[model samples]
Target: MDKHHSKYQITQLSAGEEYSIELYPKDEVVKAKYIGQGKLEGFGNQHLFISEGKDKNYIAMNDYWLRKKDDGILTYAPISSFSTLRINKSGLGEMLDSENVHYKNLGLRIIRFLESFGEKFD
Candidate 1:
């Protein structure tokens, strides 16, 4: 995902890594790598995502109940369960290598994931 802007270089994403996405607008959107499966607690302003377990501190990103709209928008909603998903690392790598890549939702997800993993494109 190595993206180069006028003054900053974009972070690079790797294959098969789990990440967290921010629900708000900010310079940094992705939260963390998601060490283990986290449980959603509270609601609205009291909502909190907690990651903790005996053997695992967190779970994979896909395992979280995420809602994707018909317009290709993804967001977290009130769901009973979350499913395990897979990321296309090779395809993502190819997109990063090309100059035709559009850094929209998917691109941003990859960038944030890389940033969480401490990858520096700068």
Candidate 2:
């Protein structure tokens, strides 16, 4: 992973790599395994990842709001019905919005996982 200030270009995550993510607030972290790049039914091409637990949860790539630009910059947009989470300047995750709890939680987990790889938000 290449770190540029608070921004990170994640070039280290490989297929089948296992990582942990916080699935819910005050809940135990869950294990997620990267299934590599593939096309999601309605989301086109995206990175596939799945979480392991009592029940299998498939996290769609489209749930991610932070995107890497061509200029190697990290940008964010509210892709879901709400903008519920954010990574603060300190590189810690914080919940800023609360309209959609489910998607927000998943987004938070994904962002934090990316942050572990050195990615950041504005």
Candidate 3:
């Protein structure tokens, strides 16, 4: 098993409810999607991200190759500015590398996780 394979619990925050942030093995192909309303909402092929870690190379990366199916694909709005953001009352620790697109991959995973909750609510 991968070192990061342990199951995690999502914490609730002012921004949104935290859901488990678990990473699947590269062999697994998890479907990603946006949380929408009504019949218009459902799961769809999407991307996911993996944090490269901090230090010399300050940027997370997408473990899998993600390609848009078509112009019809859905793109969720960017969440936090940083790939690994932990918002607390003390202050915000956000590291947004505007020149880097790896952060966007993190967004996709968040969106997918959110959609899972939406299904339960509905």
For every model shown, the clashing-pair count is 5, 0, 3
TM-score of each: 0.26, 0.38, 0.20
Q: Which ten residues in a row have the lowest lDDT in candidate 1?
A: 41-50
lDDT of 3 by residue, 1-122 (tens): 33232222121112232122322332222222222221112223222222222321111112122112223221112212222222121111121323345554444443344344442212
Model 3 CA deviation exceeding 4 Å by range: 1-99, 119-122
Give the poorly placed runs of model 1, Cα more than 4 Å off.
1-85, 98-100, 103-105, 119-122
How does candidate 2 score on lDDT? Answer: 0.44
- After best superposition, candidate 3 residue 88: deviation in angstroms? 12
Model 1, TM vs. native: 0.26
User: Candidate 2: where is the Cα deviation over 4 Å?
Assistant: 1-6, 22-29, 63-122
| Candidate 2: tens digits of C-alpha lDDT, residues 7-112 | 5233334678775543323433445676655443334545545665554455434434534434533232322322122223232223425456865575566555
By the TM-score metric, which is better: model 1 or model 2?
Answer: 2
